[model samples]
Target: MIVPIPPGERTYRAQQAFEFAGSDLAGLVLFDDQLIQYFTGFIFIPTERPIALIITREGERILFVPRLEYEHALETAQVEEVRSYPEFPGEQHPLLFLSEHLQQLGLRRGLIGVDHDGYPPVMGYSGPALSELFAIRRVSAALDRQMALKSEPELSLIRESARWAGHAHRLLQQYTRPGLSESEVEARATREATQAMQAEMGPGFRSHNRWISGAVALYRGQIGPNSALPHAISINAVFKAGDNLVTGASAGVWGYLSELERTMFVGEPTPQQRHYFRHMLELQDLALEHMRPGRACADVDRVVRAYYEREGLLPYWRHHVGHSLGQRIHESPFLDIGEQAVLEPGMVFSIEPGLYVPGLGGFRHSDTVLITSRGAELLTHYPRELEALIIPA
Candidate 1:
């Protein structure tokens, strides 16, 4: 079952951001879906129809949506005022109404912080840019930084997300076997796990087909020698005995997610494969050991990379050790060699160190780790030991 945030907290985030700014910003407008969800806990179908949230300095707030979506907003949005317009491109630009309201509310020419990277794109309609409507500032980065610190409620969701994602990984292991089609195995396992989560999540759960509140059962499941490639899915690949499997699983609840990954062998693994897997697991542990509050994100990656080089495994290292996670799948403050963001409490990341040898499959273990006051906490806790990952013949 799902628990909705109290109306008070729904608006607290936006107000807190404004309070943090302590500047000349007059109001905040949220048009991007991620921002909309983060600010209001409201989810909507993203059609060509444009929707927006506006907050004025005096604390006047409004949600502008298509007339058709008016009732949906009324039922779902925690907004005190919901102002919707007529059909799209009929005879008016939607921004016209927004502009007129801000003017009527005495906010014309006021500095409005928009929750978008740049200009808000009007999909399937023609409209003047928001800058043409009012003085604007990009506050997306500030919001990103603020949201990186997970609140207690957000942490609860992340924990649940990990549980669901870990369950999916277990299902993936159960459905996999020699002679099974990789596609068929993944499809069945994903369906089964998603259905189970839906059934357990209950009537209180609000689910949308989109990412919000959507739990993935199987995101990436590759088998055989082709699994050696990290990113590409092999075409017409078949699972076979003695083949190595590079698998990935995700559990997302309310847009927050945790990733779980493992390198599995369909049968008893060869000695050479075991050797590589052992080193890969150790590398991942080294990265985890370096995780703590106040450490630089880049420094951690540098240490892990140097270990790989010292071990003569630098050529097999592919991507960064990890990256921050949030409403979007992959957010900023990445754990790359050059990233300068400092680790902090409430920040979450993936501790995935991989060594891919072509024709031998990728050897990697991944878990979403949350930075805490003490140290790193693993969210996705599925078996990573080589023996635990073996699928008996």
Candidate 2:
């Protein structure tokens, strides 16, 4: 269900959106309760309900929620008006109600901006309805352009989230050893993430269960080369000595998340594993160095490709450099060819350079970074240092 946001938070977000759009106000429609819940940092609870929002140019906001959720939305939302629709047989559909409300606000025409991508078609009535009632023109790029830059508060949330992820990684490092099942390590990591969030951010934060695993072999019943990918599911693979372990630790603080992963050797890494890990780290650094203001995103890809080709590692560069990150795990400003958007300050993205050698598993180092006027700010702080996680052969 859509819980109402505090008026202060609503004002802050609305004002930020207005500034980002370079306009008086941008109308945002939070049609899905789940989206609203996550973006608003509300707890995820299942509900067969829909919600709508109208943020005005002057910072006044309104919410349209189902009758059952009216009180909850009122309490949780930051908007001034918390209107409700009865269970059934209402005078008008929710869309029409919203249209009327917007019309009443005297926003039926003239430079009203919206985020078509954020407000999917399924979430609200088609543009035709809105267009019929108001002079609506699609300002498709408005929200994404605004969201590209992270404000201080947004960066604070991301930094805190990264801290929790670091804590989770530490827990994984301590618990993982030879003879332990992949599921066991995953369980411990999940527990650590959950506990860390609860303690750090209180009840509003929750960690999703996820982990990763892989290996070489064991000798003398000790931990072996371990290679663990951050797996969100159970893995039956057994850990052994000399195996390489790669794991990603991710934790959500409020609705924000920070992810960091490392490659560790159960005992000592083989020459091949160490080489691959080093290359992956280098690629990560290369991607970060190439990120700058006004550089074409496609140019970023060219630099990565050139580096990989120079090292005779082109075939291993499976994915693009990175993608934008925000309320959604992956958003726009993709680091690839054909993306024309110039790099701007306040944009945040992941520069995850990866290499997947067939039959050898995959090696990827990902970090969420904010593009600043100076350069990129790395959000994840966990050490990427390659080390041997000795388990005593």
Per-residue lDDT over 267-341 for candidate 2, one digit per residue giving the tens place of the 0 to 100 score:
776788789888988888888998898888888888887888999997666778888865556667899877787
Worst 10 residues of 2 by lDDT: 212-221
Off by over 4 Å in 1: 20-22, 58-60, 117-126, 207-209, 212-215, 219-221, 233-236
| TM of each candidate vs. truth | 0.91, 0.78
- Candidate 1 C-alpha lDDT tens digits along 97-154: 7788778777776788886533255455556778877788888777777777787777
The whole-model lDDT of each prediction reads 0.78, 0.62
Each prediction's Cα RMSD? 2.5, 6.2
